[model samples]
Target: MTNEELQTLVKTISIDVFKKPFLHQAKHNPRLRTTGGRYMLADHTIEINPLVFKVHGMDELVGVIKHELCHYHLHLEGKGYRHRDEDFRKLLNETSSPRFCKPLAAQNKKSTSFYIYECESCKLKYKRKRRVNVQKYRCGKCAGAISIQINK
Candidate 1:
């Protein structure tokens, strides 16, 4: 979608969900890598990953918009807007917004250079040169089950 479309969607979601208007810009940012979306504290803008709509479709895109709107509305009103803040948490719960944006599929398209391992318990991402034995060797960080990360 175009930037204008994103702005309209963000504004609509802000009003419908939070009962507040989003006065700032909402545009697709090509630079975003891992995160689905981000709210800018400095400019009061919301940068959404374009790959979200292209890859995941509208339902997932709406969820991300809701998540970012929580930050945008709360921060503007001088309430607790940070992810860890009580007000932010309460608003997120109230609006049924996801605690965090879903990981973009674009981010999972890993290259074939190195093998990646993730700890099941701690969710710590690790990259290694050698193949890891998941059964015999546990995670170095949490002593949890180690599994290879397969791109999906």
Candidate 2:
């Protein structure tokens, strides 16, 4: 959604859940890598990760907005606003906001290891993560001698 839309949503959520008005800005921040949303203590503005909407959908986006709003309202009212604060925790529970943001799907990709080997007799394909000596290791399917292949 656009920044204007985000601003409107934040304002609506603030009043609906916290019974307070949010007079600060709310905008999509593409630079936000891990966090779903962040509340700026100095400026009271809220920055939301655009990927949250794309990856997790509107419900997650609303939850994140609520989470940040907890910080926003609490900080504005001179109450405990940090994650460890009792006031913050209580507000979170009252509003049903998530304690922590959900992990991004893009950050969940697995890393894989690649290894290469060759058959001594037929020069067949082989791949492994650990090295195997030709004298001790043989191809299981063909029972052929195995050798490591280094690529230049």
Candidate 3:
């Protein structure tokens, strides 16, 4: 959705869910990375990661909005607004807002490479970028046998 649409949606959600109107602006912020949305403490505005809607759809978008709204309303009322606050936690439960925004599918789409190994005797863990010969390798700490598991 466009920034205008996002603004309208945030306003609507603020009223419908919080019983409080959202006076500040809401917009899609391209610079937002892993976060689904952010509530600006300075301006009381909301910035949403556009990839939220693009990768997860409307439900996820609404979830992000709701999460940010918790911050918005609590901060405005001078109550506990941060993620760790009791008031914020209560409001989140009351409004059914997600504790944390869901990770965007786009983030999961990035290429990943890793090799996991566990020593047979000592159960020590190791991660490496390249594959290693299990028979030739041993745990450094205990000199236990090593095995490899590739993850991508």
Per-model lDDT: 0.87, 0.89, 0.88
State TM-scores per candidate.
0.69, 0.71, 0.70
Between candidates 1 and 3, the TM-score winner? 3
Root-mean-square deviation of candidate 2: 7.0
The residue-by-residue lDDT of candidate 3 on 114-135, one tens digit each, is 8899888888889887888888
List where candidate 2 sits over 4 angstroms from the true fold: 108-152
| Candidate 3 segments whose C-alpha is farther than 4 A from its true place | 106-152
The sequence of per-residue lDDT tens digits that candidate 1 reaches over residues 27-49 is: 99989988889999999999999
* Backbone atom clashes (below 3 Å) for every candidate: 0, 0, 0
Candidates sorted on lDDT, descending: 2, 3, 1
* Model 3 CA lDDT for position 90: 97
**Clashing residue pairs found in predicted model 3:** none
Residue 146 deviation, candidate 3, in Å? Answer: 21
Candidate 2: tens digits of C-alpha lDDT, residues 63-149: 999999999888888999999999999989989999988897656645466568888788787876666676887887789888778
